[model samples]
Target: MFTLDDLVRLVRDELALPLPVNGAVPDFDHALNWRSVDLVRLVLAVEKHTGHRVPIAELYRRRNLRGVHDLYTATATAAGSADPGSGTRRTAAGSPAAAAGPLPGEGYEDLSLHGWFARSAARHPDALALRVAGQDLSYRALEQAVEHLAGRIAERPGGRPGRLGLLCSRTVSTYAGYLAGLRLGAAVVPLNPEFPPERNTATARAAAVDLLLCTAEDAELAERIGRETGIPHLVLPDTPGPGESADGESADAGRAPGSAPGPDDLAYIIFTSGSTGAPKGVPIKNRHVSAWLSHTVPYFEAGPGSRFSQTCDLSWDLSIWVLFVAWASGAALVVPEKAELLTPVAHINEDAITHWFSVPSSLSMARLLGELTPGALPTLRWSLFGGEPLTVDNARAWQEAAPGGVLSNVYGPTEVTCTCTTYPLPADPADWPDARLGSLPIGPVYPALEWVVIDERGRRSQEGELLVRGPQRFDGYLDPAHNTGRFARWSEDDWAPFEPGEELTDAHWYRTGDRVHTEPDGTLVYLGRVDNQVKIHGFRAEPGDIEAALRRHESVEEAVVVPCVTADGTTELAGFHLGPETDREQLLAFLEKQLPPYLVPRHLVRLPAFPMNFNGKVDRRKLSEEAFDLIARYG
Candidate 1:
């Protein structure tokens, strides 16, 4: 199906290694000395393109580059011909050039996201809008269900613009619930069914939710939250039976009451980890999100035929981009169960996904599980990775697997709406940007958002703490106490070059606590965090909060949590405890009930007493140094 040259090119390009100047077969054993990531990428590309998998121990088993070419020729001769659509060459040049310069300002069709979806639904009434659990809902069917759910929400006593909680998994009820709340001019807060009930309870308490929406599966959880918070609940499918909630046919042909919510109106509230030992609510407005979609939709080239991979949960801010942007483009969003993420190649092929967005960890896990192959997903056109850095090997592997698709690494914080910057990689694997400080470059800034990196000296520089301000930036944290020192300001003189350094006035610039670098060409490169806060599996996490939760236990007196890299190269929480004469099993079990699954520490270290730094404070850094021994001795 593919030439050995194709195989050798992928290895040399991805591994950044020199191939034999003269045409010859590469030594499989020597080439196998390549980096773990690049080697994985080579195998992925070869297997997908040729349907040939080399042994993990032997690699391609070729003595030289010429040997690989002969093997490739022999393989092709053996197969007689390549499968249709197996080639990774350019497919008649891509769909036109992406417009450069600033994004068009007049493309937005409505003030609220729900309104835009309404227009799309009306325009393509029969187009597929959603697919969940093998059930497909057309645009017309989805619109009718939204209207019926809106009427039900209208009957509730929830006040105007109040918060409405939607507690459900990937189902028609959740989508209908979101539309219904927006129709009622209420801010919707999605409560993940997988999160600890206590965590959701605190989120609901923080948001001051007036109503809760749930499917039959989550009825008991809704009741618990409602009973705990005194908020009324409405069960979806209000009765027993399947398809009762999806509304396969129109409940009412006519539209529900008309409503016009402003651009600045609150749209949704997503909860993120709080350094203060509780989840913090981030309220994003319709305008904030609409501004983001204005740029990403065209950048991704999504439209009526685009099929988005719905991998993020509603609680995660990534959903904002995937959920609304697809609808605005009149595209169908394919929702897969959480478990499907483990074997994504199957779903990507079966669903013919055109666009993909997810954390690089998902890709790494898939590769670790051997779920990827060469020429596997030719349907993908755009593949974007965020939440964490995408390693050189991971990017190349994905690029080779989805040979026709473009790969990108995007970056942003929930505090600054969904996403703020996009770093699209060059289509040619050889042209991909080299890492800056060990991370792929996070390309150009969003057209509407302004970025400034401020150093510890409180002056703008090429690298420092990244700060973003513009239409996409949220108003502020939901809680006022969490807002201290989380903002910066710029004066008129600072905008224009007046002095070498001018004092700026107090104003509003959301401080993105991340430390980054700005290249001369205006590209941004993420260096590392200036603080202990981290993103584990795309969820904002604070070790202080994890430590606090551990200390809540009766046996624990002191705790410090540090980030630990597992053998598989995934980030995990490592909890070092001073008290609690306990084993890792007992502590993890206790923390499981209080923290989310991702927050649970994978490694537990118990100490007789906490270590102290020279300043008389618990030295977390010092504790991390001895983390391995502590775990080995006490784990």
Candidate 2:
């Protein structure tokens, strides 16, 4: 086992610097280098020295090289031996760096996602970042706009990274409003501008938002939500011209740029669908996003010449990832017209989009409709698939469409910044096992991120439950009781014991609740969710397989398979579908041809639209419960 001094020596060698004889490390208080890419290299070096994973959370917790070395040594020491008295945390020898107190990158301390745009403005003040509705904002112009609005917000009583709800559709004003909020050191709580007042009010109240910003189009909803939640609201014009600003104040007043948010500062609280329960907010920080951009932008080689498209909703966590990658990497973000965007393949070809980040379903639809013609998207360089499983068929189709382009499968919960794992499309996805699907190549935990797959028996393997540990990981749920039970830990200390939320086991892992299997080559294969998988007639069933098979039908648009219990308490397979021209018999035949009898749905319930929660995912529990009701009435 390497000693702390040995680890420090390795780090010095890796960074090509002289080692401190007394081992006095640099102070982390103010040592942020604007170059995020360099930090990733340091993380990799630390991992090499320790022969263990260094999670993103750990990286954010350890702000400087010195703290990284300390954590490495501590983790190494613990791995080298075992502490019988370590209790539930099981300190092998030394504890990993105690979660740095109130770091800027991860947990609840992160600034809203707009923090990246603000930081980018500082780097490239004059570059063009956004263009919409025949209007454009140069980076400098955008920066000035944000500053003027932030000045107005800062002037307001008790303004400092507090909750500021944003209600606007996908437009430049939406982006400007978000930036202005972040500029004033305030957290942005984005609401679906199209959502009804009732839904808007519930979200605002849940987040305890202090203020509301909206466009005239969403003025009514914003006003209603603000009134119900008792949060002050403001409306910005659709276009802020030469003398107008987001705030009612004049647009010409010069104001200093917003405060620089720390890496751990709370960036945004994005509400994501919870598989275990209700909709929960995932707080992301600046450094957490920085870490992701640091890794992904370089991995994809994105730059100013790159023309990227955002197909996901801005409210969706995936959309934020797409937006940040574009701005941070200096790529041009193209928000295609609503009509064109409805057709993913057409949008790519029409816009000459170089990079497209979309879910697997969209790609699958593009293939079935024959919209992925050769040379249609010749400029496409990288196509990323997220938000759902990428089956082998879909992966192969995507690869075929963009022959030379990189196809990446990204996976992560909204809680861990955006994505934690990414696997570029393989030359031969068909070679992968059918049970493994094309999905699991979830890849590695990003730089500074630590992940593991463990079974219920605590056995670790490529195939098991996925656990994540990184700076991008969420601090805790919004509710204190929820935080206490799920996010806190009880441990034995030398003195008195304390239930600190910062500590972790020798593993330093966060249970992702996702079941995955890794190939011998270390590529992750996504298995079905623990909750989604169920036994049917003593046969194991995976909904993803059935869904993938259902999607194979030419007439089927979108499909969700769920289990339902009859009034007699007998379990049955049910399918909630959103599609046109789908014949019940033909759908059943397709499933029967592709899936086993037990896995095939016995009941097919067609709907004009799937019941989607706030996060856009099919509300499976609600759908399944309603499935029984529909069967009882119609069947």
Candidate 3:
């Protein structure tokens, strides 16, 4: 057990916090102004020194040195005689085949996107289905709202729209509107209210949207987009009362239920950033998402009592996972307020979240706020990070906070379903692999999928661009023209580029553009984007490599490297880090030793935080432009 003096020294050295003099057992909350991160560090330090694990939650509740020591002693004493099997059981990788058994919609042939929720409602009518913005809806109540909204949409001027656009945020109407679209057998297109009207109008027009749905808060904006795009818009009520219909009439009056969609029919269309400055549409079918759910529902162990966090926006594909996976497993979909996202510890505890999914950038944000303390999120059982590379530091921090939870790094592009590969770290951190570039391995592709890595010379290799083709892969882009050079066919151990006017087949592999290397264990490690590689002073350099080197410094929390072009038409690398102020000369000296001189960044800038994109990933494009401007203006 640790003594009071050990706690005082650990607090001062590890956390940089002042404590009461003479070891009077000062109240950590009042005297030291200790945050969750500080308490977690002290507890971890004590455990390391004593070689015994204490109840971190109990120590946190104590909030003082004397209480923490006493609790630690009691825990140590009890643990001395405790059964080995009674400790936290190690989590194992869930079998995809096991997860396929007994879902809510089992044996339901030709199930559409909305069919999952309908089955869940029938199976668990009273179960909590949706919780958002201080409101809760049971599965039964939400299904009724979806039915009423579908009736309202079907009766619109368009008369059962074949395509529907949802213009809303994380509101009850947004979730209801999405379901309503699926209920009407219309392809749902999510439109962001935060985006420019012109962009939303273009998206609505491109998708050939027949109707637009929005909550009262976004009525004007929706109307503007509808007018510009020549589409009709309907405003959904803020909350659908238990008994009221869309227009306060009989809930079943003039109700025209749409026919169920076939497996091949488009379920939804998501627009991603394009190289030509216009968004590219990727339309996913019901079968594609069904394939994903078949693997994830059981892998995450979601069920009636589990509460999944909805961290992604409707426009992001991860939102699809949160919505359908929860409904499919009879779990509750919980959405936190925008502000609450930055402080995840409090949100997870207050909401009693069991399954959590978000971009790794969310972890970085919490780390910036000093909120990712050990055992802070004791209620979380499954935590998944995606949308960006998961750094070892971020993963360890999150794992420490949710010690009882299974932490996974999932990887995929929107072209695939939400994700296609996941790397679940061992329950014991000591057994985790020493991954390359300090990024967690992306693990193997799903057993249902087929993938290959092709080198620059067009030969199959262990390290190269990854290509995949499987049941979950999207057929092609909405615009066939965007399909050029996006796929390839392998014949006789060689690859051929997909040509225009040729039919796309399941045998064709979608070019993922991601560079990866297969480890000896058969797991794949992401090595940054092939297109993102930069040539610095006649030497090739990957920004991820440089960023990893920068993060090696004990003072650096996060790092981003971008190539900046000066006015002289010369390119140089600019390094940005989020951490305490350090002497630029000294930091560069350290990087010089770790990396080649040419790979070292020419300019280093310290930031309070990295700017995140709409999808919560680092905004590399914006940072590149900013770096160029800064370099051009200053040098």
Candidate 4:
């Protein structure tokens, strides 16, 4: 059996802590400041030495060095002279073998987005459906709220709206209003309350929104947007009170309930940042989202008793995944307060969140605040990171924090559905692949989807821009003018630029514009954006490659490399890292050893944190501008 002295030695050697020769170890909670990374290292060391995996959850309960020793001894004693597994044995919960085939209502003639939720409500009416900002609603209660809201929307000046705009945040009204729109056979368009009124107005006008729905807090803003766009506005109550029946509780309740949307009918429209400085609206049909749910609902193994985290805002496409994935699986969707999002570990543990999905940047923020302590998220069973490149270090930190959770890095563009590809990390860290650019490989494309990588020369290759087309891909941009140059055609064994005035069929591929490298086994490693490539001393360079090199340094926690245009019109690479103050000379020397002269950044800046945009992604445009200003001022 592993002794307490052995545990002390392992912790000291793994974490490089100063321990006294008298064999007295300090309490980790009070006497020692141990980071999550340190805890992971110590756990790994103990596992390696003892040959028996220590239960991280139990060790977390006793947050001291002695607790670690006791946990190790107990685990060793339980084995009783027989060698157990070296690592935690993971289940095949999310693998294809675990899938139970089609979900309920899959074969229904008219399958609207809300129809899935209604089916779950019918099957599990007593199940907890939504939890937002300390309020919980059962599936039946939420449906009643949707019905009441639908009746109210039906009595509006223009009657039932064909297209509805949701101007709200993470409030109950926002979620109920979304379902109400679907109940009225209206395509939902989520408008961010945090966004500027002008931007919201533009989006509303572009989508030709017939009505605007919001909570009381956003009533003023919704009214202003309605006035400017000539659309009617309705303020929904914060909670969808119970006892409202979909049959005919209100005078116009039964009259307002519209027919279910067909497979080809529009489900929702999401706007994404466009290169032309205008928001490009991507309209997903009911069938597209249905296809997305069909693949994801079973893959995640979500069902009753599963609690999903709602981290993405309504305006982002990822929120669709957060909402419907839970509803379709009869699981509860948990929305955290703004403050709770920063300290995700506490929220997960306190709420007993079993499924977590958010951008990788969220993990970085928690790591910065030292909230990712080992075994901190014991309730989490599936930890999903998306919307940004997930570094291996962040993956490891989160995995250690939720030792029993399955970690997956998902990837997709708004043009496609929420996600078309996923890479689930191995249960044992030793079997993880060495990613090409220090980010997790976006695993193989979904079996039902089609993908191709076209090189810069417009030929299929093992490395280049990624293009996707399948049931999940949208038909085209809302505006036909924005569709130009956004898609490609495969003809005669080569990809051709989609020309104007050509009929866009299912054969067309949506150009992802993301650069990726295909490994021998067919997995894809994401390289940065294709347009983000810059010329350094007349040699082409990818900022992601340089950023990966900078991240290799032990002192750097996060790294971002941007091309800064100097006053002389020359483009120079500027590197920024988030970590403790390190000698600039040492960073340069470290880069010199691995990178070529031109590949090395000209300037290295240390930042407390990266600026984040509304979607919780790093604001690279802001960083590039800041880098340019620094070069112009310093040079």
Candidate 5:
């Protein structure tokens, strides 16, 4: 039904991108060089032309001339099946490239981000787009800012569909640079200011960053990264520096010539640690972001009057979703004060923020510390929690802190564009402490997405590894070897054959590493990670389960149970706790009563506060490292 030719024509016309209409495939090398944003737009156009949801990696893997044709043919064949692979890769003719099936979202489709932003800007140009430190930028002002920066960017050397690094705090100018980079068709690499110079340098070198943009406050870090990476650096401020004119424009706009990339161009790279030694960069295409925002806006019911907090740093993919998804819906983004970011009570209350998105740890700390309350923060309507599991106790406390708000547990790794599944909060809080958050019911598959659970042997199961496939799912890692190993072919077709009386809709699925089972009602319950299970003295145990149990105890404010290796090289269960009133002996007795002897923690240490990652999760790796040092110091 869907032909590659038709898809190409549709893409050429809709996004106004140049396409090879002669049926001859273009050079893969040249295509790969095209900006990630342009490639994504091209994929979105193909999705629109053919009723198929093209997976992100499928589109990205089309590196050169030969790959594109195979990709198109394969996707075209699988368009209407239960599963659909994008036409970026192909198997030999008559051999299925992926499980054959219709792509997800064969019927309903949401708008693109470009369409939504354009509409919002036209309709509510005067409305607030971002609020930071008591200062606000209206939609009109934001548009002007981006356009002004985009114009200047187009005149620069590395601004045209190349790598541009942005180092700044959570401020409007940082957001502006991001937009400016997008407008110029360059991939935006957001650097973490907190990162040591070495990590920053490593990231810059790995990503092949060519430009660095930093705010005045982060000048030192920016200078360090630039010096190490040899990338040209520019400081932010509307005003130009010495020997420059008042306008922040590059002088040679008229003399320089280059191509202006389209929506399929590369937008940004969100890097995450892979099983591989080096950090793996996930190239996010403009179309991937566009497709995500198109669907994300309506699903969350965001609007001009809505206000969502800026909780995540740009380095984290979560921030991309938090910032743009809300903006696409005309929601005002509120960046709390530097001090308030951890708690964010004053900012939320003062700004009347309607939507709050954070990991469980943030909510827990805020509620436990009495920094947030339901009666005081009545304006809050929705709380979206993700990154890690939301324990029942934390959920109940969060609910009490915002009685009118509903909690949605979102689940996804950086590989998948921020979130692929979400489950709404339960209506009644009756099951509070008893709730075993094994598989957080991370709602149904979003439009154009597919999910599967696999057992230890890779067989499909009601409960197993949570594998995902969707348009939003990212392609393989930046490292080719890592990409090949972790992201591999499941089957020749998009959708696997479904046997009658089976609970899951058979499809080609990506293994999510997490183990989970599906309820009869199709809700997914999360089990712990496959690696989370450990054998102690030939006895199988789950540290997460014990930790969950401990968290339910009234005296234990927070608990982390991890296997620690003692000086004798024997593995022992160790737990670090955060609670002043909770006594170790009493808590240990309570745990002993419920858990087996081996599962009970052999060592318990108290901490005034838990060290957390940016997402607010107790940094288990850090905790483990500290455990080693503590033992060495005290022994």
Candidate 6:
């Protein structure tokens, strides 16, 4: 019933654009012909007509208006809902409803993270919930901390449901502070204290944050940032003792400042490496988080007595899984020191940890250190690897060491909640999923996700751009400009006439930027990303962001950052510069003042001039290839 003219009028009305008296209208490739606002107007117009709103994030997904039309048509014909096409993903065979064992079937009055924690803590008040560096905090104790911190936060001049920066260490206060922000329904933006003050302050400014919650270690840093940015802060003790009272001076010293954001409200903002010379913050809503939790909680099969490893930085997205998944499963979360991660077998065996999740790089490090010899970790039962590609070799080696454990390759970007795909390795080595691409297959998408691959020519292909859509998908970027070109439509153009990847009837999907292939059984194979974004020791690093920081130095004239793989199979950012005279250590220290430790290039190569391509652009490929050799010579 929707006609082309009807779409045109809607677009004109929504965008407040003048309609041509000559009756000119946008064609199918309107995005190609229109400016940014025009495309936005068109999207709004389409949504108005369809009686639904598609996220601007669809621009980063499959960006076909035709596909949007079909999706709305199909969805509209069915039972209509407020968020049209929001619940379009297909549920997997053994979904939550069918889950058995210690994992209960889906039935929860409060699905919010705050709600879940409150209920869980009340039910088993004395259960060991969290431990950091051998210090234990039972559920009841953590709840009291949450209560004390939330009340303190609420009393601040600027109060709830906005961005609250958390500067904390791996301590009880860190866990308690994170929970307290959630209790007030605020979006918690974690600022790693080790990150250069410049980086933290810049990110805080970009998010327009007003207040911060910091632990004792980061108090001075928080104070400096507050003075520098006019954002007040509260200082929580390094540890919230189990029986601390309201009169406890340490608990009340949080003299500075702090939501109840809703179920669908933003829970947190995580910034990833960006190509545009700054980090891009992905605001994940509570529902986006719940969608992931509801699906994965049962899959892990963890119970109250189970122990979960907290080896990663809380800033890492996997830390999201470690925080909620462990507590939600009624398991004790064991936070690790940096050294604990290097020798994980000891951490696992010593603590009797039952559930472990980390990047394969850390596992490789464990093997390199001779800490992961065969049968080294018999207590581990489930090992989940993510953030970077998990090599088949690493998986097999880890499997051999923890013979009683199962290895699963979890794949996703921070943009799509935490993870969207999980591939559990077969018990038999030969029966394991394909790793011909130098990594274990990403396996099947999460039951709640639907994905497709778009080739370079804009057609469907067995290998190309991996895009996904589901309830777990994020709404859009904090900066809408990042949303553009992240999506394409499902259609055949003159360049390619065949269907690409898996065919979706009609829906907008999120382009993962990572290249992949889909197998006959719907399993996905990880190829590589189509951009410069790379994983550095489990953290997503963008060369542009690092390069931008390098340029910020007074002596630096120009800078280029390239991701280089070390001999050990881990990736590191390598910066090449053509700037004023500066030694590597000096430059590194300079960088240490403006970037996160991970973002700081492992190697800095100064060049008299950059190698140029025919197009007059820097030949980044050349720099990447010579990074190691250059580092050796320079060092």
Q: What is the per-residue lDDT of model 2 for residues 402-443, given as tens digits with 9 covering 90 to 100?
A: 776778888888767788888776656565445325244666
What's the CA error at residue 264 for candidate 1, in Å?
Answer: 1.7
Compose the digit string of candidate 1's lDDT tens values, residues 1-635: 46555666775764444564434655543433333334445545666666754332233344344455455555445545655223311132233222222223456654687876887797778878888867788878877777777765665564443788989867777887787788777899988887789988888888999888888899899999988889888887732122343333334433446766778789899887443234678898988877887777777887777778887788887887788877877788889875455456766776778788887766765666455566666788888888765666677778878888788899888888778889888888788766535557878779877777877666888987887788888887787666656666654345322122333232467778777778899898876566877779999786755765676666664467888666697777788765437666777888899888988887877764455421123556656666776678657
Higher-ranked by TM-score: 5 or 6: 5
Error of 5 at 607 (Å): 2.5
Better of 1 and 3 by TM-score: 3
Question: Candidates' lDDT values, in order?
Answer: 0.70, 0.63, 0.78, 0.79, 0.64, 0.69
Candidate 3 — what's its lDDT?
0.78
Better of 3 and 5 by lDDT: 3
Q: Ten consecutive residues with minimal summed lDDT in candidate 4?
A: 92-101
- Off by more than 4 A, model 5: 1-116, 158-161, 238-263, 273-278, 431-434, 437-440, 491-508, 628-635
Candidate 6 least-lDDT 10 residues: 91-100
Q: Report the lDDT tens digits of candidate 5 across residue range 1-635.
A: 65445555554555554554344763234564543345544555555555454444445655443455566556666654544433332222221111111112333234333344545677789878877756788877776666655555555654453888888876666777777676566788888887677878888888888788777888888887777777877677743222232144443212212344555566788877432135678876666666666566767767777877888778888887778776776777878754455335555666677888887767765664444555545667778888777766667666776676677888877777778777887656874223564324666657677666666555667876777776676655555454443443344233233233333322334556676667776676665666767778889887777877787687676777778777798888777776656667888898889888989988877654556654446667667657866444332
Flag regions of model 6 displaced more than 4 Å: 1-101, 108-110, 241-261, 274-277, 489-507, 532-635
Q: Please give the distance, in angstroms, between residue 625's alpha carbon in candidate 3 and its true position after superposition.
A: 0.7
Pick the winner on TM-score between candidates 1 and 6.
1
Q: Is candidate 1 or candidate 5 better by TM-score?
A: 5
Model 4 off-target regions past 4 Å? 1-110, 242-255, 274-277, 628-635
What digit string (tens of lDDT, one per residue) describes model 6 on residues 431-533?
A: 8865544467877898778777777677778877887787888877787666666544554453322133423222556778887778888888775557877
| 187-232: candidate 4 lDDT, tens digit per residue | 9999998888899999999999998887788889988987787787
Each model's TM-score, in the order given?
Answer: 0.67, 0.71, 0.82, 0.81, 0.74, 0.66
**Which stretches of model 2 miss by more than 4 angstroms?**
1-119, 122-126, 157-161, 247-249, 256-258, 274-276, 427-440, 484-508, 535-542, 545-559, 575-616, 628-635
lDDT of 1: 0.70
Q: Model 2: which ten-residue window has the lowest total lDDT?
A: 94-103
